[model samples]
Target: MSNLKPEPANAPDDPLRRTLLKGAGILAAGSLAGSALGLAPAARAETSAGLGGRLRGVQHFGITVQNMDRAFEFYTEVLGGTEVMRDGDFFGDRIQNTLLLTEEVRAVRDGVNPVTLGIPDLRSGAQRLDVRFIQFDNVVIELLQYRDKEQPTGSGKAFAPAQDLTSPAFPRAMHVCFYIRDDVDFNQFVRDLEAESARRGMSNVKANRIVRATTDEQRLGASLDSNTNRITEGPSAGWSLIYCKGPEGEQLEFVQVQGHAKQVFDGAYESRRKQLGA
Candidate 1:
């Protein structure tokens, strides 16, 4: 039997309605984590009030992809994500207005094809989007594919290629970090990642050597000064991390905390939990 299921109906046209729905999903996931961490209900309420009821936990992170199939394989097969949902046919007035994509739509209507801008000549309505949701443990990732209606078999329009994220230092660059569980062998995990990438011939994916932080200064310096030097005697003695690039050149990080570092983390969490009161 086919495992594919029908897509859910389009979300309501109201922007606020969509925001609330998205917020609900984030809250549902955040509540479980908060409860497990022993966050006090009253304190949580007060914190929200203090923030003017604006900020909440992240709902999901999205990445635009050129090839949905390739991105799906890299995320699911390589990174061990599970497909949660897939939806398409995202075009027309609702998308244009809601996403403020009217400029692109208007340009298309005025005969300003993508080819005129030196980009690929995508099929008509190339601004339309296809989305796939994948979940990795607690985090959800949304992979977006901008597509358009199919053209004739020999139509000049071609699939766009993935763009390189030249450097993390570039403006507006962003990366996602995944925390490795304490029980997982950090070295072996990286090795397995490399092996899988090799097996799949994912040439664009690359990883740096794992860096171990031996001192609290080194840990802090890694972020502030980009220092990777080792030092003796500090709380972060066993913290290890590695930076990598995904198939689309997106930056990623994996970290494993151990030794004194794990103790420090546990203590901090417990202290916060207690401060919140139960």
Candidate 2:
């Protein structure tokens, strides 16, 4: 949910990504097909569009979780995803539990320096078992578990890292949103969701009114696309949220968005604060 880079305009790949995106849109609607659709470049090149919402497609996401095994199953089996990679090469030793392979992890693993962003939570996390899984579609979801921490109590401020705040309050900034395509087969998707919920016996499964209102509020307040907003559509009023326990007992969210999920910055809503030297 961090926007370390505001715009990738200067990057050389922008033009190519745009071209591929157009082709992908056509492919989605079946306007263009032949051997071209089967070609690897046709799909690979479009991955960039999927990440930035440029294609009006998908927005990449990362979910913080506790149980790598169960969470992975929840994502793959329950949510209907195909596993691209089953091993951990991102970490030097393929350690079951680690955040994205940051360069500093080696320095810390080798006992040369403490891990970057190492804090009490990391230390506490070391006591437990967890894992990370990245899907082929450039959708990277990380699952975590704190042997030391308990699941979220949920009545108070969510302990996860709020956009406006620095440093995690509860730890493992919880929850993740999955922005799916607009044309997903609604009937089957809902039936499977219901079946999965029932089979998994997940707690607090509901249409979640708070999420719908928030989605509408963001769309209306920010002058953004309401129809394309994935968070605002569905029988659950176009969007739905379900509270699920992460592998570590921390509360996690399986959010289904109709269009895209965007990031929020501190003081981001001030209309007069556009970047300028005025």
Against the true structure, whose TM-score is highest? 1
lDDT of 2: 0.36
lDDT of 2 by residue, 99-139 (tens): 33454566567776443343223323332222233442434
**Candidate 1 per-residue lDDT over residues 1-278, each given as its tens digit:** 11333221234553323433653575465533432223322233345444523333355678876566777788899888877666554554555455545555666788886445433322234544556677665567777665545622111222455555458888898887777777876666766776688688776676664245676445333432232222235877767777777776778878776677767767776664455442
Candidates' TM-scores?
0.65, 0.35
Instruction: Supply the TM-score for candidate 2.
Output: 0.35
Query: How many angstroms is residue 247 displaced in model 1 relative to the true structure, after the best TM-score fit?
Result: 1.7
Model 2: number of backbone collisions: 11
As a whole number from 0 to 100, the lDDT of residue 113 in candidate 2 is: 47
Model 1 worst lDDT run, 10 consecutive residues: 1-10
Badly placed stretches (over 4 Å) of model 2 are 1-62, 86-129, 136-138, 146-175, 185-191, 209-278
